[model samples]
Structures are given as C-alpha cells and as structure tokens.
Target: MKIAILGTGAVGTTIASRLVEIGHQVMIGSRSKTNEKAIEFVQKFDRNISNGTFEEAANFGDIIFNCIKGEFAVGALKSIEKIIDNKILIDVSIPVNTKNGMPFTLIPELCNTNSLGEEIQKNLPNTKVVKTLNTMWSTLMMTPSMLKDGDHTNFICGNDTEAKETVKILLKEIGWKEESIMDLGDITGSRGMESVLHLWWKIWGSTIGTFSIKVVN
Candidate 1:
C-alpha cells in the first residue's frame, strides 16, 4: 500500500518507518520541500521513504495519514485539497495546548475537542475520514511489544461503514487484530477518543509505562 504521512513530526516519522519496514511505499510530506536534513532522515530510516511537498505526498498515497498539529491541520490540508476527496484519511490529531510538557484537550462549542477529525470530514465532505491512533502515544503506534501489562486499547470512530471497514483492514495490517480494536462508531464518537488521551497519559506516567491495553473476554 502506498501510504503518505503528512507533518514529518514524531508521529509521522514513526508511522512512516513502521510502514516501510513491513514492505509498503511510504512518503513524508512536509511544509518544506525535501531538504538535505529530510533526505538524510528518510534515507537513514528506510530506503522506501520519499519526501515531498504536501500536494505531492497527498496524491502519492493511497491513504493519507494526517499527523499535523491540530492548529495547523486545516491549512495544511487545504494546501492539498484536490486529492483528498473520496480518499480514506486516518486522522491522528487532537486539539492540544502543549504547555509545560503536557497537552490539555480544548473544548469546542459543538464537537468537543475531537471534531478536527470530523471537521476535516465535514470540510472535505467527499473524504472518508476515520478517527484512530489518537488515543495512544506514537511510541506504541507501530511497536506493540512495548505494551506494558499488555492491556491497552486503540479506539476508532467514523460515520461511513465502508470507510470504517477500510480502516480496520489497515489497522490489521499494522498488527491490530479485529477484536483487540474497539469501534466507537460515527465521527462524533471521536470525543471519547480525545478523553482516552488523558487515560493514556496517566497510564504512561504511572506503573504501566509504555505498554498497551488489549480487551480480552
């Protein structure tokens, strides 16, 4: 699968490396065109990684992972508006106010803090946006081995049935089993995911450390 990760930050870098490791064409799209540093990072990480401008990466990916900071997400997306429609976009963003090494979720009038995922869906209208990978830290996004107590959950929510299934398939490809993943349902359900970030942080800071949660019956 050709996967495009926007933003080139920690989350983007982690996801890109994971996808590349298991044999996928991965590209990193940044605000800046591929610079020497970007080239070096990608080359060092994996030979499969291609760095490009926003529009280039959007069009290059079969599925685009929007990993930009929430504040800049809208504009960053708008820059590549043409290719977004009808594509499956997995939004891993949260509205965060990072002060003193902590991020607090913002309160939105209608949609709460998680609406950025749905908001992107609403604005794009044609894109199939599934909200996932926002609950846990990027550390566990790819490597499930670090999961402490081995009991953690990654939540997904979306409106479209087909889109949700598509996302589930992708998640499975990344080693998330169907039962281990919880489908919260509908884009509005993303609010719960944002709240889980609080739980995730607390767990990370506590005894659990970098482990994950799995729902077992």
Candidate 2:
C-alpha cells in the first residue's frame, strides 16, 4: 500500500518509518519538498520511503494519515482537499491550542462544539475519515505491544464502516489487539476521543512516562 504522511514531525516520522518497516511505500510530506526532516528520512530509510510536499505526498498514496499538529491541521488538510477525495484518511490529530505556553490545551471554539476529526471530515466530505490513534502517543500507536503486551484500549470512530475496517486492519498490523480496539461509533465520537487528551496530558505529567487506558468488562 502506498501511504502518505502529511507532516514531518515526530508523529508523522514515526508512522512513516513503521509503515516502511512493514514494507509499505511511504512518503513523509511537509510544506516544502526540501524539509530537512523529510529529506533526512528519505536518506535514512529504504527506497520504499520518500519525501515530498504535502500535495505530492497526498497524491502519491492510496491512504493518507494526517499527522500534522492539531493547531494547523485544518488549514494544511484544506490545502490539499481536491487530491484526497474518495480516499481513506486516518486522522490521528487532536484539535488543540497552547495557552500561556502550556501545551495540550483545547481551543476555546473547538471545545464542546467541534473536533479536528469532524472538522477535517466536514471540509473534505468525499474522504473516508476514520478517527483513531489520537488518544495515544505515536510510539504506542504503531507498537502497542510495548506496553502491557498491548492489552490497552484504542478507540476509532467514523461515519464510514468500510473506512473504519481498513483502519482497524492497519491498527492490527501495528500490533493493536483486536479486543483492545473500541469502536466509538460515528465521527461525533471524536469529541470524547479527542477530549481524552486533556486527561492524557495530566496523566503524563504525573507519571512522567507513557501509559494508556485498558477498558475492563
């Protein structure tokens, strides 16, 4: 599968590397084709991995992962709206804003009324947007077994069932347990999924380590 990662940040790089490791054709895209991190990734990895501008990467892939930071996610995605139509978009971004330099804070307008997942889906109506991996860090996202043998829960939500199924397969490929994945229903569920970041931030600060939720019966 050809995969497009729309960001050259930690999350995007981590995912692109993993997909490449799994033998997928991966491209890490940024605002410019000459992005240092993107170029470094291409130079370091196998030929299956490459770098390009956002639109180039989007057009190159069968699937798209929006790994751009929450603040700029909407604008960045909106820029390549036409190329992404009719493709599955796995949105792992949260809609957030930093306040007083404190990160992980939610944007005032986004709280309660909207979420980055829904906003992206709304703007790109033809794209099959599945919201997942936003609730956890990038490392845990593609390597869940690193923690408690991958027993923790991972949530996914979207309006399209087929898109969700494809994302679920990708999650399983990355080692997420089948039973550990929770289908939170439609895109509106992104509100709660994204809101979890607030508590996630608090938990990270107190523990100073990576941890995740494991739903119990």
Candidate 3:
C-alpha cells in the first residue's frame, strides 16, 4: 500500500518509518518541498520512501495519514483538498496549547465542544476521515505491543465503514490487535477520543512512564 504522511514531525516520521519498514511505499509531506524534516526523513530511510509538497504527497498515496499538529491540521489538509477526494485519511492529531506551562493544555475552541477531527471531516467531506492514535504517544502508536502482553485498547471513529476497516488493517499491521481496537461509532464520537488527551497528559506526567488505555469488560 502507498501511504502519505503529512507533518514530518515526530508522529509523522514515526508512522512513515514504520510503514516503510513494513514494505509500504511511504511519502512524507510538508508545506514546502524543501522542509528540513521531510528531506531528512527521505534521506534517512532512503528506500521505499519519498518526500514532497503537501499536494504532491496527497496525490501520491492510496491512504493518507494526518500526522500534523492539531492547530494547523485543517489548513494544511485544506491545501491538498483537491487531490484527496475519496481517500481514507487517518487523523492522529489533537489541538494542544503549550503556552499555559507545565503539562500543556488543549485549545478550548478546537477541542471539548468541537474537535479537530470533526472539523477536518467537515472540511474534507469527500475524504473518509478516521480518528485514532491521538490518545497515545507516537512511539506506542506504531508499536502497541511494547505494553506488557500487548493488552491495551485503542479507539477509532469514522463516518465510513469501509474506510474504518482499512484503517483497522493498517493498525494491525503496526501491531494493534483486532479485539483491542474499539470502534466508537461515527465521527461525532471523536469528541470523546480527543478529550481523552486531557487525562492522558496528566497521567503521562505523573507516572513518568509510557502506558495506554485498556478497556476491560
């Protein structure tokens, strides 16, 4: 499968590298063709990987991963809207505000009542947007098995069933178990997933350790 990763940040790089390692053609996209991170990523991987402008990457992939920061996600994706029609877009970004100090904070305008996922879905109505992995660290996003016995939960929400299934397969490829992935219904459910970041940030700071949620029945 060909995958396009927007952002070139830690999350984007991590996802892109893992996809390439697993034999997928991966493209790292950024606002500019000369983005340092994107260029560095292509150089580092050197095989089965490429870098390009946002529109170029969007046009290149069968599946697109929205790994950019939440604050800038919509705008960045909007720039490539023409090329991403009908594509499955996996959004793993949360609108976080770091200016408040300490454990960082979420921008109320973009979260809580309204989430970045919902906004992105609204903007790109033609694209199938699935929200997942925003609740965990980038490291765990690709290697969920790092947790003891790989017994943990990850959530997914999207408007299209087929698109969600495609994302599920991709998640499994990156080490998520079928049963461990919880489908929280359609796009509106993303409000809950995005809000979890508040608790996640708190727990991450207190424990000083890496962990993921496990839904026990």
Candidate 1 has what TM-score? 0.88
1-217: candidate 2 lDDT, tens digit per residue: 9999998888998898889888899988899988887887789964798889999999999999999988898899889999999999999987778663676578766667888888888889999999998888899998998999999999999999999999999888878889999999999889999999889988888886789987899
Kindly list the per-residue Cα lDDT of model 1 for residues 1-217, writing each as its tens digit. 8999987778888888888988889888888885554576687863778998878889999899999887788778876777987888899987664543555544353245546777777777788888998877786877654665224677888888898898888887887756667898899887777666667666767864455556666
How big is the positional error of residue 7 in model 2, measured in Å on the Cα after superposition? 0.5
Model 3 lDDT per residue over 78-185, tens place: 888879989999999888876677666777777778888899999999999999988899989899888876689999999999999999999999899999999999
- The clash count of every prediction, one per candidate, is 9, 0, 0
Flag regions of model 3 displaced more than 4 Å: none
The positional error of residue 191 in candidate 2, measured at the CA in angstroms, is 0.6
- In terms of TM-score, how similar is model 2 to the real structure? 0.96
lDDT of 1: 0.77
Q: Candidate 2 — which residues are off by over 4 angstroms?
A: none
